[model samples]
Target: MENRSDEFSQKLLNEMNALYSLLLLFFYLITQIIAIYVNFCLVVMVFRTIKDEYKYPYYPLLFLIMFSNVLFVAMTTAIAVLGGLSRIVPALAKSFPVLIMIAISYPTVICVLDFLLCIHRFSVMFWDSEFWSIHVRWKGPLIFLITLPFVVLISSISITYSSLLVGVEIDAFGVGNLPLYCFISDIALKSLLGFLTFVGYVLILLRVAQQNRKVGKFTDFTVIEQAFPIACFQLISSILTVFMHMGVHRSAWSFAKVCLLKYAFTQLLCIVVPISIIIGNQNRRKKFRYFCVCLKPNQVEPANHRVCITMSNNRTSTTETSF
Candidate 1:
């Protein structure tokens, strides 16, 4: 009986492993596809539509965000692909400094950019004239430019230090990792930031609620609502990251497995902003309607979406407005 049980358990485990492997490979391919198609479309559309944001106070921040999303997809896909080839080709793996820089530096910049993005929304939503108008002139863009290098600098040091602690094991990480301790720390830093940003969003939402009660003040939820999608995801991702990392490491998941999980969630992160922004912009959404005739040209985005993009918890669009 004992021997039979052991055999059954082994067989089950093997079957599960095989399934996981197939799924992971599928995910990797999807990541590449998303990187090329989605990011490419986003890049072109954003630059083409650059002039549209001229009057919008939060436009520069969106530009930074769109640029980061483009970088996020492209850089992550490159890292995932090259990181795999590197493992097979030891010479390429030795290119750690460059790989490490791109891997850690970029997303860390993104996390900061996201937080700044949150901060930007908060300012505009709450302080339309006092803080926002002032910031909009030169302060917002200037601050983003000034702070970017420092964020990257901090990220490089963290990656380098962590690598020193656990050796440069840069194996296919789109948004996440090293040895157990090192990996935990990496996730911890991002999650902590995500948490803070999430809290910031909630606060902004509460403030918006308050503002709704008041009159005479010009308060639209446009910027705040646009940001809510990311803010919500950041909080969710932070928790998910910690959970997924623990599971992957304890099971001794392969580099590809790790990358797949990261890629899946991170790709969603890359997608949400562009989708939300585009949907909010009447012109861009019109452009989408033009391209995707499957969608009703008269079909409207989610209501309250000039300020928020809400959908059913389990909704899949046959149209472009799904996001």
Candidate 2:
């Protein structure tokens, strides 16, 4: 009877693991597509704006954030796909530690980038001259250097603690049980960074909005307003991550679902932010549309002859008459 009960328990666990692996595979593919698309669009948009001579010094920081997301998705998808396969074939399980390290570093890098972006935005709104003077460009590299040691220290401590809690489980057959290192500690750190980012964004937006209100000008405030969607996206993603950590202690399947939902929402944010900006700003949208139209072979015009001569002739005649 005891042997039969053990068999039943093993069967149930295997079934749950299979379901969880399938869900991870699905989310991995979806996030990879979304991350690539969004990163490409963001790069195009950033370059286009730069070409147009809109020198918001904080722009590069935003690019870094998008770049970090791209890296995050790439690392996560690789791990999910490989880890899922490893479940079926123990031979591929050796890479599990590297996968965990990638997973831990991906979000850590993103959180650091997000915090840097917040600081950049705050400086732009509140200390424009000083930001541009010497600190603007150096800030990103500085933050990276400062955060590296802390990340290493905290990650080391977390891994050690986690391993102690759930010792390294290895089967006689060479397949090892993966350690849940950095999961909880990383979430705690990210939640704190997310909160700071949210507050910084809110304060910057409020300041920008107030300035616009006083001057009765709205154009500059558009960017601030558009940023609200991204802010909300970050907030929601952070909350979901916290919930996922909580769920993991209860049931691994529940935790996997939460992770899937988190990535889905992140992809939604990636696609929605750029679309929102293009839709909300009519002038920029029109300019982009016109640019696209001009890309067609038949639509191209010689630069010297593109402008009608009539307007120039009229202006010349007016000058002659004045003389």
Candidate 3:
């Protein structure tokens, strides 16, 4: 009786494993394709459709963030392809440790971009000086310099953490060799980022709310208001994903499923987040819609001539003013 029970348990586990392998493959492939399309469209729009006078102060950051997404998606797409193929050619499993290593740094880049934007907005509001304004043209080089140390540090930590992990070559999912740990470095990075971005988002929201409530509010936080949707999405999603991951923190089928869920949420959020940033600004959306329809509007509206777009429980209004 004991021997029969052990055989049955083993068979059940095997059957379930087979089922999940197929599900994971489909999930990875489908999400990667959708991400590629959405990010590609965003890249084109940012470069081609943007009006010169649309002086979105965070334009450089926004562009860099979207472009970073493009690179991240491209890397993930490659991971999905190679992971899918590794099943047939078992030797390919060796490279997953390296690939996942490279892929993990992508999110750190997003965090850096968000932090820079948030800090810049905060500086503008609090300092109210020509500090950031004076070096607007040098924002690119300035960001690169500021973030280089962080990127380097994160990469080193991730590599060290990956070495500590004992990856499974053919886990229940039967894809590439999977990390046995719950992506410890990734969780740490997200946790740190969650804290920083939370502070930044709260400050931005509080300041924007105060400004909006003013009588004839002349100097509203236009940049923060415009970046709010995307920033909010980033914060919410990061918190949720970290919570979800904590629940399934082990090397098992549940762990694989949890990771898959994270990736799915990622694909959805990446597509929505950039669009949210664009939609936050009314004039930009107008030109975006026009460009999508393949019609170039002869007169492109500028951001200085503001068109306010606000939503309160399904209500929206557009109040024009000098931004």
Candidate 4:
């Protein structure tokens, strides 16, 4: 009797675990799909609206950030969905080199971009130089071009090092159990960049305070407001990554929980910039809405109205009008 009871309990537990994994996968797929859509919309919106202005640097910087995010999120979503499907068919477990490339490259690009954004915000707001006011149009793209070589070099080194992670098993949900040493090395680099970005933002804030005191009103805070959420996420996500790393060496159950939390934060990172832009800036929000509209204005407009004007010669002209 006791043997039968034990078998029953084990079977029940196995079923529950299966159910949990299924639910977790559903959550991941849905959230990541939404994130991909949002990030892509932001990319299109920026591309359509980019133009010459003193604050123009922010647009290209933002465009690159969202463009990278759209690609990364789409790749991750595919991997995650396949990760779940692989359980039912072992053939789906095939790993690809692009997975390794993305794992090593995406964070490097994002962290660097985040820091550049902070620097842009700092320079534009804190400095009164002619270069920032007049030449930022070309300077933004120049800096991005210069930074590319270093990012590629660093990512190549990391990928080579990652290849040395023998028997690094990726879970059914596509999360890798990276060794603490590997995780820390990557996190340390990101943390250093994040720290510098935080410092830049702090200096900009102090400068804003000083200017506000003199002018007796808030001045040039829009960009700062837009950047604040991203900076906070960088700090919070780093701390979460540390905790997630700690769980990687533990039990599989614990690691599964960590992966769910990691996905939540990852998707949240993809969504943050879009939400920030939509809420913090009016023009970008309008542009984003414009991009999201499905029907053409002429198709969606109400029935056209006709108007007639009579010229001095008693000639009548008719025009169709639409709003």
Candidate 5:
């Protein structure tokens, strides 16, 4: 009886592992498809807007957001693909550490970029003249340069700690296990960043809402529409990350399950937000309407103007006779 029980338990475990492997492959394919669609849309939008001579300060920030999204998709897809194949490919299995670092770095950079984009939009709407001044642009680059070193230093330290304490080990069948790193510290940092981003975006949303209330018109819905999707994506991604971190520390849940959930949430963001932006543009709607109007033939002009003038002259003559 004891031997039979052991054999049955082993068989069950094997099935679970096989199921998890299939899930990973499914998720990887879905994310790749979404990423390709997003990249194509971004390219089209950028090409359309590139020749505009107006100094729309937000263009650069939009471009940065799109570029970051592309990077996120590419890096994330690579991680998923390589991670899935690590069981079959020894080279990929060994390079898992570097791949993990790249994955983390891509999202970190993207988070920072999202914050900057929100701040840039706020500055443009509230302080248009000041934002456009030459001093602001020059100073901005200097600030980034000054801060770049510190960001690199911090990320490097985190990466080193993560690599050493949480290495990946692969079995002969290509299954990989990644240990959790930074325990309390990682959760705290991620929570802090997530909270900060959420707050910033929420405040911006409130400001826009307030302005819209006063104006009784939404002059530009593009920013508002895009902001909500981005905020939702950021919030969901951050919360899932924290949850994954906690799950890693607990033995009750499988690490693979946590990773699958985390990546699934990420796939949601990569698939939904950018696509919503492209489809929801108010300007694009107007342009489409105008195109339809132009395709039709023009109608004849009204004779009301000439008739009104003749009626006015006759009224003048009648008034003179009555006097």
Candidate 6:
């Protein structure tokens, strides 16, 4: 009786664990789908809404970031899903390293682009530079041209590095051994970019404070104020992911748990950027709400329904006005 009871208890525990795994897998799939959809919408919205007055490298950079984010989320999802599939089909495991490389490359570009976007915003807000205004026509194209080489170089290196790994072991969670240099290089680059982006935010806030003091009272910084939290969340989400990867060496957490945590961090980062863009900016929010919330496509069109993009001391703000 005692032996039978012990066997029964162990079987129950196994069943419970299997159920939890299925639930977590379902969650990963759902979040990945949501991330991909949201980022794609943001890309479309940013592109379609560009007007003559919206001429700035800021919008272009934003479009690039969202586009990269969509690819990043998609690649990560593919890695995870394929990694699981490789368990049943051994041939699939061979492609895991290549998938890993594709996944790593995007986030590196994202970090660099984030830093560049921050610098551009800082320049326009802190210096109130005429440079962005004066060179408006060429600046956007120039920024893209300049960014292309870095993208190519990073992607090339990632491909080369993944090719170098032999007998790579991929776990069910798609976690695998990265070359030590590749691992350290990735972490270093992201840390540096993240720090610089934070500093840029600080300088922008200081500029806002200076303006407030000159006015002898507080002034509205609604847009900048809203953006601050979103930026912080992105940074924190990114930092936690790095820490989670680092903790893999020290902690006894299972590979599945580590992978899930990393996925959650990444998915949250991807989802939040679009959400912040839609919710933090008044114009984008109204446009998003109008299109997404309204059921009837033929709803009466309002007069003067236009989105105006304005750059002030802190950042570009979108305001929609309708008569």
lDDT of 1 by residue, 183-255 (tens): 5556676787788877888887788777677754555656656666776776686687567545543232332
Q: What is the lDDT of residue 84 in candidate 3?
A: 63
TM-score of each predicted structure versus truth: 0.64, 0.61, 0.65, 0.64, 0.62, 0.62
In the range 136-209, model 6's lDDT, one tens digit per residue, is 33574466568667654544353333322322232322324334454556666666777778778778888879
- In the predicted model 5, the residue pairs found to clash are 87-174
Residue by residue across 1-323, what tens digits does model 4's lDDT show? 44543443344345347777788667766777778777777666566556622355566666676677777777876875676676744323233334445545566567777787787677677676565454655676677779777665555454333322322333322334333344545667777887787778888889889888898877756666766777778777777776765555334344435545655666677788666655566566556544543212222222443443333222334555644
Q: What does candidate 3's lDDT look like per residue over 243-293, in tens digits?
A: 865575334445445545555656665666556555555555655653442
TM-score of model 1 (CA atoms): 0.64
Task: Estimate candidate 6's alpha-carbon lDDT, on a 0 to 1 scale.
Answer: 0.57
Q: Candidate 5: TM-score?
A: 0.62
lDDT of 1 at 186: 60
lDDT of each: 0.59, 0.54, 0.58, 0.60, 0.52, 0.57
Q: Which residue runs does candidate 4 get wrong by more than 4 Å?
A: 1-20, 52-55, 77-88, 95-104, 128-183, 250-263, 288-323
After aligning candidate 2 to the native by TM-score, how far in Å is the CA of 42 from where it should be?
A: 3.0
TM-score, structure 2 vs. true: 0.61
| Backbone clash pairs in model 5 (N, Cα, C under 3 Å; residues 3+ apart or in different chains), count | 1
| TM-score: model 4 vs. ground truth | 0.64
Collision count for each candidate, in order? 0, 0, 0, 0, 1, 0
**Model 2 ranges off by over 4 Å:** 1-17, 46-49, 74-100, 127-134, 152-185, 219-228, 250-323
- Give the clash total for candidate 4: 0
Error of 4 at 76 (Å): 3.7
Ranking by lDDT: 4, 1, 3, 6, 2, 5
Top candidate when judged by lDDT against the true structure: 4
What is candidate 3's TM-score against the reference? 0.65
How many backbone clashes can be found in candidate 2?
A: 0
Q: Model 5, range 1-323, lDDT digits (tens) per residue?
A: 44543443344345456766687768767777866776666556656655751155555545555676777777756665666665755444444445444444444554555555566666655666565433333444454446545544444345443322233222322222222233344445545655666676677677778888997766464754665566667666777777665555422125435545655665666666566556556543333332331123333333443222212211322112111
Sort by TM-score, best first: 3, 4, 1, 5, 6, 2
